[model samples]
Target chain A: MILEGLARLGRSGLGTLERLGRAHLLLAGMVLGIGAVLRRPGLLIAQLFNIGVLSMLIIGVSGLFVGMVLGLQGYYVLAQFGAAESLGVMVAASLVRELGPVVTALLVAGRAGSALTAEIGLMKATEQLSGLEMMAVDPVRRILTPRFFGGVLAMPLLAAMFSAVGVLGGYFVGVGLLGVDSGSFWSQMQSKVDFHEDIVNGVIKSVVFGVVVTWIALFQGHDSVPTSEGVSRATTRSVVHAALAVLGLDFVLTALMFGE
Target chain B: MMGMGKQRGIEILVGLFMAVGFVALFFLAMQVSNLSAAVNSDGYQLTARFSNVGSLKARSPVSMAGVRVGRVEAVSFDKDTYEAVVTMRIDAATDTIPDDTFANIFTAGLLGEQYVALEPGGSMEYLRDGDEIAHTQSALILEQMIGQFLFSKAGGD
Candidate 1:
């Protein structure tokens, strides 16, 4: 029984390794597929509409609420120490350093990523990908490249939008509603948050997340069985795996970027 | 899967989305971060040596008459002198500061962050880049002051 358990563990471990290798192969194909997107930019723009514009409302609303909550919580926490004037800096720093990119990536992974996997998996299920291949059109170039680049290009901008909106939300809560001095609120944040250190790093994190999330979504769809149930399973797996990857990579990235 | 007109509409909406995203990035860089508020790029550097910097760090404000004139660019240690060497970047716009200005570290409030305050001196010569301030006062540690107070009380007995 113990030997059987060990064998099962080894089999699962090997299966993970195999999947990792296949994901890298798909990544290479995607990289090579960029030429097709560059040749016809309209395809990429269409995918951008689906991936980015569609995701904006959720990103903006969530960002505003998150920032408002941060402001409210930060004010009360700092008030206990008579440091309420520092609320803007607190809110901006936390949002820029951690929340903005991370939350935006999480939202995109759930919104666009799942949809991407579902769409691609369904295409494969319906033999659409096979049809394109039979016609001598590379599905990876014709279909996958635009969608992948769309996610990659959209991520940093979405993260920036989230952070900007969130900062405004914090300002509204802290200065407009909570009686904090507006000058101190903005000036304090401006003085404390460095553009290169905070803002740029957050953008970098979001871009990395975009690449990773999109890569996972595309690979899962391409690798799924050509059936309805397989497409559904691949869609669910894309989200769960992308979320865990984002959170895990966040810790590693924070350590590298800000760890002293 | 859509007609040409519908496709063009999507392209327009995508263009709008891209424009809005760029605007948001601009807002982050300008208002949320200190990209626009940095000291002038053509600023000159001045150095000062202190016995103790306490919790003073690089990027701390350097002010004259409670108005910020520059920023602390770097904080290093002088191995030979056993002192802290601070490098400051003062805006070229404020080029009239005297050579004999005194640099002193002060806290904002009780248990607040430390900053360097400059007291100008009367001199015909103005400080230039690489010039070192002659007079410097280090940051005051509250615990050391309390310890000295207790020591003085015991000594009085």
Candidate 2:
């Protein structure tokens, strides 16, 4: 009997995977279509406000400390070589290229992704999703699409802000407290950063991360059974999956971007 | 119904606060970028040649006498000469670099950023644009430096 049950579970798992794969493709297409439509300036503006602007407080405060720590650590290492002025360039480049987007994505995954999963799960449990479907409305297009776009739009802007704040934090420590010349710090940063590529790459990474986080959350929420226990499970899975996806995607993007 | 209304109001307020904060932060970032640009404008220009570019990057500062006078503008490899050519923009107000000046690539700290430092020479001829500073040193990677330092210390012991 145990053997039979295990076999049944295996078959069900495969069936679920197949279903999820198909659902993912459909969802992807829908998300892309909705994203294109929402790219309209007015809608984008609303989304930017919802996703990017609102996330600044957490990003900023965290970024400040990140920058300070980077400055402190970078300064110590550079001091040994009597080359401390390069601290500005080091801090700026690292913040722009890697730290900014990765950190912001992780933070968003924790806060927004979890909330989205839980909210959707609760709505599903309360039969709202079913009600919408019965009314001939596509839940994926109406509910998931808006959230997916919002998250995708917000990640980059928030990441950029975090990086900027981080750099400022480094500046505060390097110039104000550490006695490194402020002029040197800023000049070094401007020289090192290729505003076009580095900044754009950061933004692009954030958008991708945002989409991934939203998709994972929605997927988990939609699949959840209509029970409180199921909702809790979905919430936990969404957060875990979103965080891992962020880190994994970051690595892949970095490898692709800097491979040459 | 009243409880739900109050909860919704709180959510809206939180959202509004986030929006306001983002705008304020973005404005601040723009100001910082402007300030950095202004600072860069005050620096001078200098050029150097290296055999290897390694991880050297532009916007890396050029310091002399513990003061930053310039930053790297461009990095390119000279195929014919088999050298890495780095052009730097120096602050106009700074004193001129002499002919025999030595350019050394150094780090800001351990695992920190790399930069070029110019040690001025007492030569009569001053460097001009397009003129290359003859003596140049490449960046000393941290691992290599630490390894050497440890080896030498152990050898002495």
Candidate 3:
């Protein structure tokens, strides 16, 4: 029984690896097709609207809450040191450096990622993908390309919104609630945060996460079996995989960005 | 999946969102990396050496009486003395520094950055082009001090 269990473990591990390989191939192709999306700007715009603007309300609301939390936590910690004025610096740096991009990506994956997966999965299950192919349509270019571009374009913007709102939330909590000197909060934040290092690096991280999460969602949907149960399972998998990928990629990017 | 009018609205919304994002980015750059203090200012070079620099880096502020007068241009180790040598670029507008001025490597605030604090000397003549600050003090490393404190406490016990 022990030997059988070991064999089962090895088999499952190999199977998971093989599945990952196929998904990698699919992601590469999906990314390459993004260039073609530019030629069909209308489709790109459509997908951008469907993906980007639709996620704004949730992004803004969550950003405020996250920022407030940071401000509260940072103020309490800093207050013990008698340096509550630096709360702005702490909040801005934390949001711009890490939380803003990562949390935005998580939310985007949960919302738009699942939607993208379900849309594609449903299309696949309904034989619409095959129908498109029968009509001499390159389904990848017609469907997947625009969605990929849209996600990549929207991610940085969403992250920016998150950062901006987070800063405001920090302000409300730190300055308004905690009575940290408003002037020092702003000045200290300005003095400490580097434009290239903090903000731009964050934008870059969000862009990378956006592409990855979108790729995962699309790949899972494309590879799913054509059935109702399969489509729902793919949708769930897309959200979970994209979230994990966002977190994993975030760790690597953080290390690389600040390792110097 | 909507009609033509809705598509136009979505496009408009996307454009507005992108605009807001770019504005936020611009604000971040301007606010965080404030070049207003260092704009178009030609400067003179000055040098100082220290036994320790702590976390001081190039571009660290050189402040005079709580005001930023210049920035550290480069930080290097002297081959012979085995000391940290810091090069500073002082603003041309403020060229009245005396040669006897003491350059102290002190940290700003409790947990803030290490900076060069200039304490002026009582001298008739002003310092000029590529002068070395003869009076220098090294950075106070916190960890070393903490270790010393612990050791002293243990010995006392």
Candidate 4:
């Protein structure tokens, strides 16, 4: 009896492994099929609009507010040490190195990622994915490729917007609102922030986050059970998973890139 | 379904967004950082050595007479000499620096930021490209000084 139970446990474990492996294969297939889909720029552009431009207002507004807040908090703390002149360096470094890419990724994962999962999940539930497959049109190529490339391409651009706006916002608050010297605010930031070290790393972070978030979104949508409830559940799962994945990957990437 | 006009509109918006994105990035590189010092100014290079650079980095200003004249271009270490080699890009217009000018790493606001402050000497000769600022004052870290001070006081007591 124990032998039989052990055999059953091993079989189920193997089954779970096969399912996970199959999911990876599906993602790989979608990745390989990008060349065929990318020939059509119209689809890619439309998806880019959906993923990035639609996110413009929220990212821009939040970026400004967050930057202002950073300025205020940074000034108060820096002033206590009588180093208010270095407030610009503090704000810019904090935003570019840590806040800008990570926060932008989290926001994008919430808005664009969830929308993608829902759209793709609904299509799968409605048999549209299979319908395309039946017509000999590869759904992964036609459906997934554009969204993946769009998300990946748009992410760095959005992150740059967030950083730029945040920096400006900090400038307004620190220099305009507060009594910090305008010259020092601008010069200190210029002197302290390294283009290669801080800015380029931030872009790399956003691009990595974009790829991972979209991959999770597309995979969860395509893998969910074919029902309305299943689609909704997958959509919810996509947002949660994408957020966690972005944060976790941010930590790992930070350790690898900046740690030592 | 969205109409063709609407789809094209969205594409145009994305295009505009990207254009602005580049502009913003340019502003950051040019105005908010010293990355554009290469393209924006014609400058000659100089080198200085220090025992400690502290937080001094590339693009830190090299000021003379309380006016900004140039920027630090690169920094490296001479392992054999056990000293830091700092390369500076002095603007072509500000080429009157004396050969005997002393370069001191000055801490702004009692330890906020560090820059090389150039104090000119009475020497008639001017420094040229590849000329070394033989005199350099390394950064004074507060923690190390405090540790030394505490140790000396305790020993004295």
Q: How well is each residue in B55-81 modelled by candidate 1, as lDDT tens digits?
A: 999889999999999999999999999
Model 4, range A1-260, lDDT digits (tens) per residue? 99999999999999879867877887788789788666888888888889988999999998899999999999999899888988899888888878888999889988899999999999998999999999999899899989988898888888888988999999999999998999889877886787777888888999898888888888888888889899999989998988898889889988988874
Ranking by TM-score: 1, 3, 4, 2
- Chain A TM-score relative to the true structure, per candidate: 0.96, 0.89, 0.94, 0.93
Looking at candidate 1, what is the lDDT of residue B143?
98
Error of 2 at A20 (Å): 3.9
* Greater-TM-score candidate between 1 and 2: 1
Q: Which parts of model 3 are misplaced by more than 4 Å?
A: A1-14, B33-45, B109-112, B122-131, B140-157
Docking class of 3: medium
Place model 2 in a CAPRI quality band.
incorrect
Which candidate, 3 or 4, would have the higher DockQ against the true structure?
Answer: 4
Query: Candidate 4: which stretches are off by over 4 Å?
Result: A1-16, B38-42, B50-59, B73-84, B135-157
Work out candidate 3's RMSD over C-alphas. Answer: 3.7
Weakest lDDT window of 10 consecutive positions for candidate 3 chain A: A26-35
Highest-scoring model, TM-score: 1
- Each prediction's total of clashing residue pairs, residues at least 3 apart in sequence or on different chains, is 0, 17, 0, 0
Error of 3 at B12 (Å): 1.0
User: What tens digits encode model 2's per-residue C-alpha lDDT throughout A123-225?
Assistant: 8999999899999977776666766777776777678778878888999988889988887787656655655456667667877887888788877887777
Evaluate every candidate with DockQ and list the scores: 0.89, 0.11, 0.57, 0.66
Model 2 chain A scores worst on lDDT over the 10 consecutive residues at A40-49
